[model samples]
Target: MIDLHGFGNQLLQGAVITVELAFASLIVGLILGLLGASAKLSSIKALQWIANAYTTIIRGIPELLTVLIIYFGATSVLMSVASLFGYEEYIEIGPFVAGVTALGLTFGAYATEVFRGALQSIPKGQHEAAVALGMGNVRKFYRIILPQVWRMALPGLGNLFLVLLKDTALVSVVGLDDIMRKASIAVSSTKEPFLFYSAAACMYLILTIISMVAVHYMEKKASRGIKRT
Candidate 1:
């Protein structure tokens, strides 16, 4: 009974952590995504190869595998760097940072595909028109392509973000005290796996519901003045 109350708070905190992880990853991933999409679209051979490798390698691996590899591998690399600097106590990558990095890497890979499709969807005439008007590539992208790309990509990006948010629960495997982790502790103490797990499910559902609302608002805002069927 007493433990249940505390468990509830723990789960709530974990849910918040999960949301923060998702948002942070999404922001970082968006930058990678835009660059990668541009690379794929560009005629630059080297940039295109790098971008293609990023998406292919990430997409080929399981998300859980990516998290595990990055969490452990990153810490190892960081410790090596710190040791080179002769300040080696221990270099630790906390759960939050690990969670964000893993998710960001995975999300960026997926986002690249979404952005690519959106970029291709634009009529070639638009780019030609911008060029004919003497607008530079950078200016044309910011003034024209970005707006439409964002609008077109929002639906796909929103879908990917929701998946990223849910997958944050898996970060517990790397010892992240995410909601699922806290719930597991509570279940062990209470010997009520069903109850605690069910509660955790509800918490996740709540997050999903909130995301849906936000996504809808965003789609509407992005699509303003553009007709949809």
Candidate 2:
């Protein structure tokens, strides 16, 4: 049994924070993906242009850069906006908030393409059939189209979530006390870089394994009614 030098609890707490960060980012990304896919598929050229620009710019950059930019830039932006409302003082964005925003944006960019492809893969006949049944666009989408889209998008979204789970380490650079950051601290105190870092690696591996199982279950549930060829 390798000793953690009493830092095991700290690491566990950090792991909890990592899980929270990933889930928060996932929710944000899912919402953005839905909106982005809708915009891309909409008849409005302006919406298409905006969505295209968002995915293009976000996907082109590195995730670390996105985190750094949001972490530092958000504070400045908030300060400027606050000044307009007659508030004086530094409005600092927390590292967790910045982490979520950055990761969510990156995830959403990739998920936009996933969702777009899924939406396109859906047959047009369904839409026509819904129209024939006098279903409004909103009702038709919620009742008929969205379920199929969710089923189709689940695999891609699950993969993206696994990536996001690992990417939570990037938040450590912004001073978030995630697993990486906690391990760094432990290494510094115990001068056991190899041990602590190895422990951190195991933590991440455990997280990935758990996430994989969850994703597999979700995919299974989502595909329940569909017949596989």
Candidate 3:
């Protein structure tokens, strides 16, 4: 066991922060993804164009650039807005908030496609059958379509989540004090780059393993009662 040299608790705290960041981003991304998918599927051409532009622009840019843009851009925009309101003080954005916004936007961009594909994969007959049963559109969607969509989308979302988990490290660049940032601090203090960095890697690996197990369990539960080919 490689000793953490009294930085164990710090690293653990950072790991917890990382988990918090990932979960917060996941929530934001899920909401955006649903809206994006809905817009793309809607009959409104304007909504489809807006959704397409969002996904395309976000996906085309580097994730790191997004983080930097949100971090600095938010501060700049807030400061400008504050100036108009006669508040002259400099405005700042929290790293956590910026990180979540940037990472969530990136995640949502990809998740939009995953959700769109999942929504399209459902059989049209099932929808017609629901309508024939006198179910309203909202009711049919919630009662019949949603469950299948969730099952179909789970694997893709699971993969996106793992990527998002790793992307949490990007927040460290903005001084969020996540696992990577904590490790960097430890390395600077103790001058043991290998030791602290390795510890950080281990922590991330542990998180990934746990996430994978949870995802697998969710997938299994979601697929329950479905006949397998």
Candidate 4:
């Protein structure tokens, strides 16, 4: 057993923070993905353009750069807006919030494409059938469309989440006490860079494995009605 040398508790705390950051970003990403997909599918050209621009721009940027921009740039923008309002106090975004926002935006851009593709995969004939049956829009979506969409989108979404989980390490750059940061701290204290970094890598791998198992279970549940041909 490679001794953690009293850094075990702090590393565990960092792991907890990592989990929180990942889940928070996941929630934000899911909401944005849904909205983006809806906008892309809308008849309005403006909405489609806006959604397209958002996904394109965010996806184009580097993830670490995105975190830095959201963290520092947001503070600048917030401070500027506050100055306009005569509230000249310094504005700040916490490390956790910054991490979640950056990771969420990146995750959302990809998830938007995932959801859009999934929605498109659902046949138009099904929608026509639902309409012919006199089903309301909401009823049709809930009863006929959403379940299939979820089944189709879940795998891609799961993969995105795995990426997002890893990206939480980027938050450490912004001073969030996540696993990577904790490992850095341990290294600084113990002068054992290899041990701490190796530990962090194992922790990340453990998280990935757990997420994969959960995704597999969910996939099974979502595929309940499909005949295995």
Model 2, 61-137: lDDT tens digits are 99999999999898898889999999998776899999999999999999999999999998989889999999998
Residue ranges of candidate 1 with Cα displaced over 4 Å: 1-5, 79-91
Residues 1-229 of candidate 1: C-alpha lDDT, one tens digit per residue = 2357468788877777777888998898899889889999899999999999999999999989988888889988988888899978887788778888888888999999999999999999999999999999899999999999999999999999889888888898888888899888888888999988888888888888899899999999999999778
| lDDT tens digits by residue: candidate 3, 1-229 | 3458989989999999999999999999999998999999999999999999999999999899999999989888888889999999976679999999999999999999999999999999999999999999899989998999999999999999999999999999999999999999999999999998889999999999999999999999999999887
- Model 1 scores a TM of 0.91
Worst 10 residues of 4 by lDDT: 1-10
Give the alpha carbon lDDT tens digit for every residue of 1-229 in model 4: 3459989888888999999999999999998998899999999999999999999999998999999999989888888989999999877699999899999999999999999999999988999999999999999989999899999999999999999999999999989999999999999989999989999999999999999999999999999989877
- Mark the regions of model 4 whose C-alpha exceeds 4 Å error after superposition: 1-3, 79-92
Supply every candidate's count of residue pairs whose N, Cα or C atoms clash at under 3 angstroms. 0, 0, 0, 0
RMSD in Å for all candidates = 2.5, 1.7, 2.2, 1.9
For model 4, the local distance difference test gives 0.94
Stretches of model 2 off by over 4 angstroms after superposition: 1-3, 82-90
TM-score of 4: 0.93
**lDDT on C-alpha atoms for all candidate structures:** 0.88, 0.94, 0.95, 0.94
| Candidate 3 whole-model C-alpha lDDT, 0 to 1 | 0.95
Pairing residues by index, what is the TM-score of model 3?
0.93
Q: Compare the candidates by TM-score and give the number of the best one.
A: 2
lDDT of 1 at 57: 95
